[model samples]
Target chain A: MSHTVRDKAKLLARVRRMKGQMEAVERSLEAEAPCGDVLQLLASIRGALAGLTGEVIEGHLHEHVVHAENDAERDKAAAELADVLRTYIR
Target chain B: MSHTVRDKAKLLARVRRMKGQMEAVERSLEAEAPCGDVLQLLASIRGALAGLTGEVIEGHLHEHVVHAENDAERDKAAAELADVLRTYIR
Candidate 1:
């Protein structure tokens, strides 16, 4: 789904930062930086990505599933959405 | 991703029942059923639908976001995922 420009902008900013960090991480690997520091960076990146995924899913639910007019359709839609969430939560 | 046959079957069953209920609801409206009864049915359908949506979102996160290999990509994905969950939780 298409997001608002502001939303897209914010996400892009985060992505850019992540890109820079990752590039630096690549350099660290080449330079044989401390394993602990590399692991820490990996963890930080993982957390940030998880947060971004949450945003997209939430926006989709609000715009599509919440306003569904057909009760049966809504049920189906919700189930499909929930199926995704169950995995995320797990 | 395609679901297993069992998952699809179960989802179909729920969908079918929801369809039947919605049809019955329409009939009730035509017959002027009690407002309270109609409202109660509406509530049940809404809950079921919400549950479904949660599932789909969760599934997508696990399949796509969780297994990201690139640190930059993972961070971006996670942030998006979290953005979605925040709304779901709310």
Candidate 2:
């Protein structure tokens, strides 16, 4: 089975929670809550989505890159990941 | 200024790198690289995208939630973030 399939239940749970947070943001907007409140809600939702993305990334790393059998493959994976990280963190 | 606006150049550079990684994945597939190689490339791309998501999340947390003017707003933001995290990490 694919790693994602193995972790489907857990990943779906996160997505569901993110959906709920998004709904709350929508409701806040509809209710004309303070702009500050709405912004806070949006920030929370963004963080939730980020968490979900991070989980998937971690799973991919463990399943694909970290476990590769050969040094060349591992080096390629590490280099690609490093390059992206340098850009991402900036 | 909007946090994203202030950091637009940096964010765009990351996005461009992610785009390149995605293209590399595509090329690997086209060239009939090993499945493991393709998977590793995909994993790297996913990690890059996740990194971008994380940056956005961090910026939102700092700009919107952390800096809110009142206790009530902060509490609300914290609660929402906590709720989402409870599900996200599972």
Candidate number achieving the greatest lDDT relative to the actual structure: 1
Off by over 4 Å in 2: A1-90, B69-88
User: Each model's RMSD to truth, in Å?
Assistant: 18.1, 8.7
State each model's CA lDDT, in order: 0.64, 0.56
> Model 1 over residues B2-90: C-alpha lDDT tens digits?
33243677777777877877887898899999998899888877777666555555544444444344546545655665565775543
**Model 1: CAPRI class:** incorrect
Q: TM-scores for chain A, candidates in order? A: 0.70, 0.71
Using Cα atoms, each model's DockQ against the true complex is: 0.07, 0.08
lDDT by residue for model 2 (B1-90), tens: 545566656665665565465456445544545444544554565565456556655655675588866887678666665654464455
lDDT against true structure, model 2: 0.56
Model 1 chain A: lowest-lDDT 10 consecutive positions? A62-71
TM accuracy, model 1: 0.43
Which CAPRI level is candidate 2? incorrect
